[model samples]
Target: MSPVSSFLWTYAVGVKVLLSQLLSRSFSLPVFPLQNGKVAIVTGGAKGIGYETAKHLSRLGMHVIIAGNHENQGELSVSRIVKETGNEKVEFMYLELASMQSIQQFVQHFKAKNLLLHVLVNNGYIRWPVNQCSPGAAAVMLVPQRNTADGFEEHFGVNYLGHFMLTHLLLDTLKQSGSHDLNSRIVTVSSATHYIGELNLNDLQSRHNYSPHGAYAQSKLALVLFSYQLQQRLAAEGSHVTSNVVDPGVVNTDLYKHTSWLFKLCKWLTSWLLFKTSTQGASTVIYAAVSPDLEGAGGSYYVNGQKVKSADISYDEDLQRKLWAQSCNLVGNPERHQCAS
Candidate 1:
């Protein structure tokens, strides 16, 4: 077997083993009842695990807003969730992850409602493999070294900076919701590939030594670092907002559709072996958002619903702050605007 195939076969077997264990234990999920009238916004909620999470949250009685790249998909997801849960509280909004203008517009629309935001899920993402120059536009792939229109790396721009700006814009609403309970949260969706990433202070955008996967890993690592740093900043400033990061555990999602054919074949093999269901993949996110166990926890990294030690690189305080600074610079928020301010 090819190395990729071998890996996939091993992964598939692992999944079966894990599933057997899960099924045998009669494991019951903990229920977290929403106390106040909570509102949640889930970016990229139109499909895959994000959609599952929105549906799950709606069933728990929280009003959910699905922010999607396409208006049609957003409407469809919202309609499905409302139909499934028999709740009219779910809604949809348009958000193009690639454009800062769209993000600003979405936030402005939310602000007009004067509603408090109890939870924010940074889940929108894309993974194109390489550049495809077309008429009047440069469509860069998700490779390690490429510049976005904003001049930051592509992965960094979408996965980290976009959410960074969105979170900043919605900070006031989060604070308003948490003033009553002090448990408001920012749940950042990261990935396990982060362990392989390293910080090259000299080339944060991978201008010289760019590898798409490597750059993507760096972005995810930065996300974990950002989560920790934000928590510390809030604590230092004596703010009540909590920030935590989680890895959904590999599942079959469209997040990888842009990968090369070789990668896709490998993924298919492994998914047939050890992949998670969309609902299972979303469990950690739900836990972070609602589980009383995390009521006051902040700056922690979670996987599959349990808090665990992250990769060593994820803890480098100097790196975390540096990454934050760079992210701020890239997003045009160089002043490091306080999320709770």
Candidate 2:
């Protein structure tokens, strides 16, 4: 997209987000008073909106487990939340989404705890410089082609595939929890950038053509697609575990740490003018996880605690199905084993 076009599109989306927040301000988020027995796992809960999300969920009296790669930061986050919320159930578990082995290990450890999971928040992401190795490379060359330890594109692997595996691995527990209350949920944190992404099923990792923005957007789109598809499968199997996506509008977070100095300066200058606070950005996630109005509501996109229509492409069932099949294959689900309830 051209500079002017990009700017205008961003401005329009920002206005819409602000309006949504304004309209929903009077709607008080429901508090879960009987959440003492419930459990929630939030990925990337060490910092940014994820940290705030973990804090909020713990405040509701739920047993919250924060999974992230940073050991010290994760422990610190767990300590702070426990001190603030006085919910000692909050704990941190090590997880590196860039590696399949790490995701499996984390899931295995959680399962060994023998706790029923009421919510799974897939909220972690990374944004690296597309051409950090060759800073002077051309635009195409600047596209991030880096792969994860699993040999998948870094963004795709961490943002979409890893969560995909984690969710499937824990599906049984989520279903077991829902058997008692029918309110278990899987909340996938997506972004408005999904609208700008072009899903190339043939080249999901972007081996042939790549752009940093395109790869990031594609990962988010894949997340939404997975959310919808998962919801559909759950419904078809007569399960009550709902799956939904959230867009935390333009928050100033560490996700942009890899940006250029010029971009950083510009963001600092416009931070208050454009960005949402981490707490504000996390509100939608909390809403999706516990909102009474959303009980059993699946396959929806939410912003600022309200159900909102997603990008045009997000409604394409064919695209959603294709992405789901490809994701299963990439994750080694060759037989397409139905996720156990």
Candidate maximizing lDDT: 2
Best by TM-score: 2
Writing each residue's lDDT as its tens digit, candidate 2 over 241-282 gives 999999988777776654446556866887776567888889
lDDT of 1 by residue, 192-296 (tens): 766656667677777764666666666777788888988888778666679999888766777664456766786677666556777877888888888878876
Give candidate 2 regions above 4 Å deviation: 1-32, 126-143, 260-262, 334-336, 339-341
RMSD of each: 5.5, 5.0
Q: 296 in model 2: Cα distance from truth in Å?
A: 1.1
Q: Candidate 1, which segments miss by more than 4 Å at Cα?
A: 1-28, 124-146, 180-182, 260-263, 334-341
Every model's TM-score: 0.84, 0.87
Q: How close is candidate 2 to the true structure, as a TM-score?
A: 0.87
In candidate 1, position 22 carries an lDDT of 49
